[model samples]
Target: MLDNIEADFPEYAPRRPGAPKALDGIRVVDFSHFIAGPFATMILADMGAEVIKIEAPGPGDDLRRYPPVHPDLKHGAPFVWTNRNKRSVALDLKMPEGVAVARDLIATADVVVENFSTGVMERFGLDYEACRKIRPDIIYCSVSAYGREGAFADRLGFDPIAQVESGFVSMNGYADREGVRALSPVMDISTAMMACNAILGALVARERSGLGQAIEVSLFDSAVLMTGYATMQHLFSGANPQRHGNTSPDTCPSGVFRAQDCTFYINCGNDKIFQRLMAQVIDRADLAEAEIYATGPDRIRRRDELFAILGEAFARQPWSYWQARMRVAGVPCGQVRTVGEAIRSPEARERGIVTRIPHEKLGWIPNVTLPIRYSGTPIVDPVAAPAVGQHTESVLRELLGYDDSRLGRLASAGVFGADAARRPRQDAKV
Candidate 1:
């Protein structure tokens, strides 16, 4: 397993020791789980917001139990990937005391994020209107399958469902077979990014007007947007996109090809790039200057023939040989790599995209940092995702000023579930 790998991997370090972070002084009460909501809040947490993740008392977030669980961490790999730089607080929202405690936290928070079904928050009295009563300037964001007030709001949806419903699946895979959904949770991830962007915009607006507003991001809506310019093209041409496998419908000679030693992808986005690929990289000026392949449309009309010729030429050399020639010719190309290969590639290492971070029990664990860079304000140094309810006592003590006696009373009332509330207070930390 990657977690067990021992090597001289670089350790994560603070970019600016004493400098302020972009979202410093911000506090977010995150009632989200799984990918979309948690990922959005994780981005906020990465930017230095104090994100308090509110999970259910017993099982907590479902992602915590996802496959490939780490023994020492007691959480799955996916949970660790998205929940870093945040505090966990387990609360039984079914109990009134738990709801009261949640309201108390909201009063002290600048933002609230949730991904529950339509009426779940309202049932717990944590909806936007209710939260606004607690903190009028709160930036409340909701992530759902559909619009919160729409007819389809009650419909349950996940990444694959959204992909199919939004026409994303229809535009992918090979033309000869049924369209295939992307294995990755592209819809969920893109929805998270949209939610984060919306929240950031809301924060900026709040700073200007001293007012906060409700923000909604839906997986279905985000999935539709993820279809890219294809939607616009469909509107303009009155036609839906057809699956073309690795090859592009708009460009010729833009797809997967095999070199002598490896497979690679090349994208000739325009005529000039195609010209460069044939004339300079492959040393085929005849093909480059041929009238049959002069323009994008012309080449696209003869895509199969061009691809066959290019394939033969690429197969004559190893990836390194073709890669070097393509680099000199200024052609855009890359080797098709697996996830493991890409993560450990020279590019990933040189950019410091992956590193090891200290873990209380595991010594160190792999960490993937965000791609953002700022000259003035840098991202926060990542902290491992907390154990279940890891900061319940400390957060209650510091934020709500609850003493041991009060905590004991709440625990006795079943506010923090069976095991969590019974745990020794000293075991929980901030």
Candidate 2:
């Protein structure tokens, strides 16, 4: 059945034709461990950057042990999602030799990204200053929970914590209920996007000035920035926005409404769209003409009644019916898809958003393709995330030109371990 389509449809044939890609030859030395920093580097990697991920010797990144580990995978899904399309090298940066090797890698890299807590890199003597000394044209990006010199610099933070501290949590969920914190890693991913933007901007600047600069992005700052429009409303208009539960505070009919079997979101932001939606999609011309529902503010003032009317109308039909009607009416609407549904959706599959790459241990794993699509250059298939110390010997010998004796000495001293495959074949080489 599948062969029939490939044989008949030339456009949809399984021909390995090369297409246009964007990014070509950039190199990134990723020193980041967790989601935010690594995510940024992953985007760059997808844009065709040669991203080398440097991890510590022991246990590797903590994310490797995170939950939802596929039965055949050593690391969890989150780790795989954040760390595809990169090379891994384990180093004991606390040692002088290890730090030296890292410095050499930086010397050959175009960008350096790290999200360590404030002063960790400085303590290790691998901060921006040190890297810049080796490569004056390096784009150094420091991502943290807070800025390095800020009052909250030393305090640890994650996505939810930043959401609370940055006022995002206060504006979410129900009006009558307490503010509900988002379980999604919005702050982490948003901060990653911001960091990526800064790094790309710095790269552009470096092209002009023939020099590099250090850039900083923090989750706290990004979370606050995401709340800009809402914050300004509070400041300029003296309106304390309350949790309205799935609805936009400034726009009416901009929230989830239920149907017979599913829920969908409809965003009627402008009066014209609202009128069109009412007349075409709902066939409610009288409701559109009512003075209480005519203007934007009037709709907000009578939001409860409007919601009741809309909700009842929507409840009368199945979600698919409303979706088709709304599509024809040019109203912005979408069904709320679960993670599995969205990933396996026809549109997602057609766009190649979900791709399969083979792993040594796991036969094939699904990796979400990077969203950026280029016309001239595209991301190549990346090496799977390494097992602990997977390339220890190869990295040391190739990067530093270490001999067998030097590599043996390092293994004996516990500075670095040999490859996993060689461990059972021989004792410590040193």
Candidate 3:
């Protein structure tokens, strides 16, 4: 078992103090909640941005109380996963004092990220214009389900809705059934990536312009972008793609098939690869020379026949056998592992994708490291996700120079209430 990084890698400063990370020293005020917005900001935080997440005064982010709450963290697993490396400050933005404090924070921030419905920020007086007034070089990132303008601007949209509206759902699954939404939040994750990309681009542009810009990203746009080849086919050939289950219309023998012990996917994308796969894995040199399967189109045309032959061959051996043989032949192949399997697999462990970190309360809890790698400045080892307003007093003192009396006054005024109180030291209970 791997020990906590802080203990094991004592000399590792992950990123050197003077050395700049990809977004080192950048300040971000994150107002987004739930997955998409938080996910994007999480990436920024991992890259060394100082992200301060403002949450509601009471329960804070909804995910805090979401089900599967960890006994030690008292928050959902998903929430902890997305919010590490961020400072949590609970505030009732509805209050005048809270709003004033927020303005002060924004005044010193390089970016403001929010995903409230189209004009909610404007109504709250935290819109781009307001931020620009305080800090001329502020990057205001507004994430929405649809967009800032147009008919659906105010309409509610989620990952599934984006998939349906953008024609992405139509390209999934088999034709026998109505195309289904992906089990995972594909659109949300993609939108997060796009939003991060946009922020990075704006940061680069700002370096030269000495000004800031308002950035917009929508779930619909990300969904449409994800339909790369599907959109291309429709645009160039006037063809509507059908849902082909576990097989590709463009490439035959490129999907899952059953082995004696398990199932696996094999991609014989082109004729040359198919020939190699046949000769190497199937031990069928004669099959490669067969006229009917000489080219991609020909193999695609005879997909059923080809599938029948390949299927029988694959079923003769177990998944591990084929996985090794196919990989050795330089073909792209892998076993269809479950989520649990994938997480614990040797490849994932070796890459340090999943790691154990010592949480204040949990002692040892698992965290997934940021996937991006930079030679000069890698992500800093994450601090444990905070309890509600865990850094309230410290942040107030350090950032705004608030003394004990001022903090007490604010607390008494309900700016910071019961939930903001320091948690009593406790043993691991999760």
The best candidate in terms of lDDT: 1
Question: Model 1 residue 150 lDDT?
Answer: 67
Q: Candidate 3: misplaced stretches above 4 Å?
A: 1-20, 418-430
Q: Provide the TM-score for each candidate, comma-separated.
A: 0.98, 0.89, 0.93
- Write down the worst ten-residue block by lDDT for model 1: 421-430
Task: Please write out the lDDT profile of model 2 over residues 319-413, one tens digit for every residue.
Answer: 88998898898899988999868866777878877665555655555667767655456555555566555566665566568788776666665
- Candidate 3 on 297-376: residue-level lDDT in tens? 88889988888898999999888888888888888888899987897788887777776666665566677887787888
Computed on alpha carbons, the lDDT of every model, listed in order, comes to 0.91, 0.78, 0.82
Cα error, candidate 2, residue 18 (Å): 6.7
TM-score of structure candidate 3 = 0.93
Q: Which ten residues in a row have the lowest lDDT in candidate 2?
A: 6-15
Against the true structure, candidate 2 has what lDDT?
Answer: 0.78
On TM-score, the leading prediction is 1
Residue pairs in collision within model 3? none
